[model samples]
Target: MSSPVPPQHARPKRAMAVVWASAAFVAVSAAVIIVHLAGAPSGAVEPSSYAASNAAPGAPQTVAVGPSSSPAAKPSATSPSAAVTKTAAAPPQEPPKAGWIPVDQAAWQAQVAAFKARKIDPVPAGVGNLPEFRADCQYSHRLADDPIVFPDMPGASHMHSFVGNKAVDAHTKAGDLTKFTATTCKPVVDHSAYWVPTLYDAASGKPVETTGFRVYYRSVRNNSTGIMPIPTGLRMIAGDAKKKVPTPRGAQGQFYCAFYGPGDLDGIARSTNGNWPICGGDATLHFMLQFPDCWDGKHLDSPNHKDHVAYGSDKGCPADHPVRIPALTFDIQYGVKGTTQGYYLSSDTTGRSASSMHGDAFLMWDSDAMNKRTKDCIAQRRTCDNNGYLH
Candidate 1:
């Protein structure tokens, strides 16, 4: 110690060196802190992977960034502002795609007015007698779908034989019909769709589809006055699909034999179960279903799918259903002489008879064609063929 006391300047130099080292250490620590700040967001908690994925499209994510570490600085799990933002970002709930929904009154009324503007005249006297027009269709496809009854729900119904409007299915809507022009029916103007329960041979469990399907639009009453054209989206169902009672030879609405030449309309013999007819000679099995001719002038459809329509009497339509429309008839024919084991409709849960045979019709036609045909053929009491021309 005594020897060091002789060099005071040397002691000062050593002290200066210690100060420089301290400054360097402080500078290096500051640089490290700056680099960390630049790399990542400050005061941000990592967001959950699920929350990021489930955020509504185009919705802004809430991110908190600040120096404070207090709970108030963070977003609350159930904050009112957050709830409002989420609700606003979500899309509105949509109504069911298909059902017995009400028709657009304003739109339908516009269609009615437009139809009335199209003027048409009656045919010459004695040119035709019956008030009818027809659409001849071939079988297009078969499926367990019913657009009228079980719309928007695929495979919800029993198997059905379809005709007209080839693209029809359980998802079909009334307005979507015209877009599909490819149809099985002639007179391409008729874009309507029809379906019936599939007929299956009970013996072999095989399907027997329709050989010919003729849809006849006619005036049931002799008085054709006030017979307005069928509404564009009219849907009607004929016969009760749930009717399980035996359809004997004499039963009403039973299948019968049809032929061009001499033969009984009820067939010469009956099936083993007496539900179906055994055609004789050149005849074939045929079923005729007639829908109502009067409408309520309000609903395009009803809860039961038949309440909006009513059968008019010989005099005129009823008071409730005042609007008179064409009576729709499904004249369906099936080839095959008659099997001993008979046949069963797809809707026949009883596995016994053809009493469950029923028909569904969804009407769609070119507005001009429908209005003209209704005026010239139906209103005039004249028969029109498949081409909507007098024969």
Candidate 2:
């Protein structure tokens, strides 16, 4: 009845609408439940069903978890320990000592003391012939009437002739032999001896006495040809000699004051110019001392030698004797040997041919003679020239 209705079709449509509405409602509820579960904070209890499925009792819980508010914190694994540990600093090292010490220091002092205790026997004094020959004696090319130019001796002959002729003429004119005696020979001046005390430690500031002392000399000849020949001598004198005599390793002192040369002859000539006109040429008779330990021309194993004086055209001989002229140069050496406290004096000339024509003498002296001569010179303020005798 009810309008006989649209029949069963309209009723079925209404029933379908109601079923769709119910399905939609169920879907909306499911979505709401999922969002709530996702939004919940950590450590917060979930609904009963979710808590039972995903969480366990006594576990770490989070509440209201959100985006991190600050940077992640570091763990405590790398933290410093409660107890403190410290290390001490190392000490500095010392510098090394120098090798050379002052002569007054320990090692040098001991050496000097030992040297003083060792007694040296006295040596005999006598005239001795030099076993070697002489050379470097001749007239310079520039000099007139080159006196050294003998047929056999090329260099030394002129020097010999000059000296011999002057000596003979001087004696003849003076009419007295006493003035020309060996003792009358003049001493050389302007000579020096360097003393380098051997120190125990050469580098130290302390002073140490030397174990012994040494005597050194240099003989040089210059020619117009621009050639210069220098020879050197070294002598070791032990400190054990008499207290009056220089001790080998004792304090610094100079034994020989004068270094004789041809120039002295010039002074003598000037003094006696009225007597001998050619006396100036005789100055070559002056000789220098050479020690035994010196370097011989024939020997190569000798110590190295050097000269502080230089060679030049203007560098004239100390006596104003002609430097251009060749000279029969002689050097002397004095020292102690073995256990002898006395001096060992030796002479060396230029070469054999030169010395043979112009002979040279070598002499040894006892302490008495040495002291007497040295004292005599000191008293007179004159230089001691002669070692012993003239060859």
Candidate 3:
């Protein structure tokens, strides 16, 4: 009887069936929040898989994307990556380079034993073993054709940097650099090839290689003249484009502003007006060109590669350019940073005034390593560096 009294319309039909099941669970939770706000983005999580792709001719119904948890990501051979790691190439150590760090290792071996104890004391025209040898080449790149001032324009000239010929320029013709045979130079007997003038900041055209090259094949008179081997379609022209001559110092087109490490750490050496200084904080920028050890023995190139070459005076090669080989000194080095408001010479292509700016050399070597570094380092006067050993 008591139970029957509880049926007050069955409690209003069970409260109208709990208000229609709470309005059908708020309409299925607002349709699952509108399908998760119309399918993700910024809540990011779209990886369930979809196929049928290959469009880019009219690209449309696509489905190809994956790879970017980012770890040097590189996926996409039509997608197949696990966050790239690859790794392998690394075994050519020798330099603080590759973003540069250099500065220790006993101060770069005491700036290379004070550049091998520099000494040219009264050795300027006797013509043999004067500086004997030194061909260090390292820095490289820069161009502006100069087969003696654009011998058929191969870029015209003014931004030099050619170390040991990667096939130099200006319409190259030391017979197109005699059959290549790979070289960057280092006792392969003197692979010949060197260049300069290119240390930028010139209001930021940005350029600054050359931090190694000290090809100083000497003979400033002793045996007066005993070296040979440049003759192979030889062509020349050294410094004086207008004259920002990096380190030339006389007896023939000289200039200087020196200094390169070991008085403390990065021994500051700069006065460069055109040798274009900007060193340490990240050092770089150097030059010291010098050529012309007379040589009119018989032309191999001369349309003005300095008219058959001449400039060994102090009483020597003037007997009508008689002959006295080996005389080149080009010590360049530039990694550059900061300071700069001066520098020129891509052979001053007509803008001259880094003192007339100049530099052009083309002597295609490798001819058995330039006749075995002219019969073993300047005819045995020895002291190699251009790779003929003995250094």
Query: In candidate 3, what are the lDDT values of residues 1-391, reduced to their tens digit?
Result: 1011110000111111111111111112222222322432111011111110001111231111222223233232233323222211221222121121112345334433443343322322222221245544553334443444555444334445566645454554444455442335454344446665554444433444554444555554444344455554555666455443333212122222222222211123333343333334333333344567777765655544565767654356667777667665454434443344544443342332344434455655544445555555455554333343332
* Poorly placed runs, candidate 3 (over 4 Å): 1-143, 146-151, 156-158, 161-194, 202-215, 218-228, 232-257, 260-329, 332-360, 364-377, 380-391
Q: Give the winner by TM-score: 1 or 2.
A: 1
The worst-scoring run of ten residues by lDDT in candidate 2 lies at 1-10
Q: Model 1: per-residue lDDT, tens digit, 1-391?
A: 0010110001112111111111111112222222322333121111111100012223342211111122343222232212112111222243234445566778767767866786666354334455667787877766666777766655566667888776676678776677655677877899998989878777766668788776777775647878788878889887777778887776655676655444565668888888877877766676766677789888888877878887666678889999898877676768776877778887783546876778899999987788888877787776666655453
TM-score of each: 0.72, 0.15, 0.25
Candidate topping TM-score: 1
| CA deviation > 4 Å runs, candidate 1 | 1-100, 121-126
- Could you tell me the C-alpha RMSD of candidate 2 in Å? 57.3
Query: What local lDDT score does residue 362 receive in model 2, on the 0 to 100 scale?
Result: 16
Order the candidates by lDDT, highest first.
1, 3, 2
lDDT of each candidate versus the true structure:
0.62, 0.18, 0.40
Model 1 Cα shift for residue 143 (angstroms)? 0.8
Per-residue lDDT value at 199 in model 3: 42
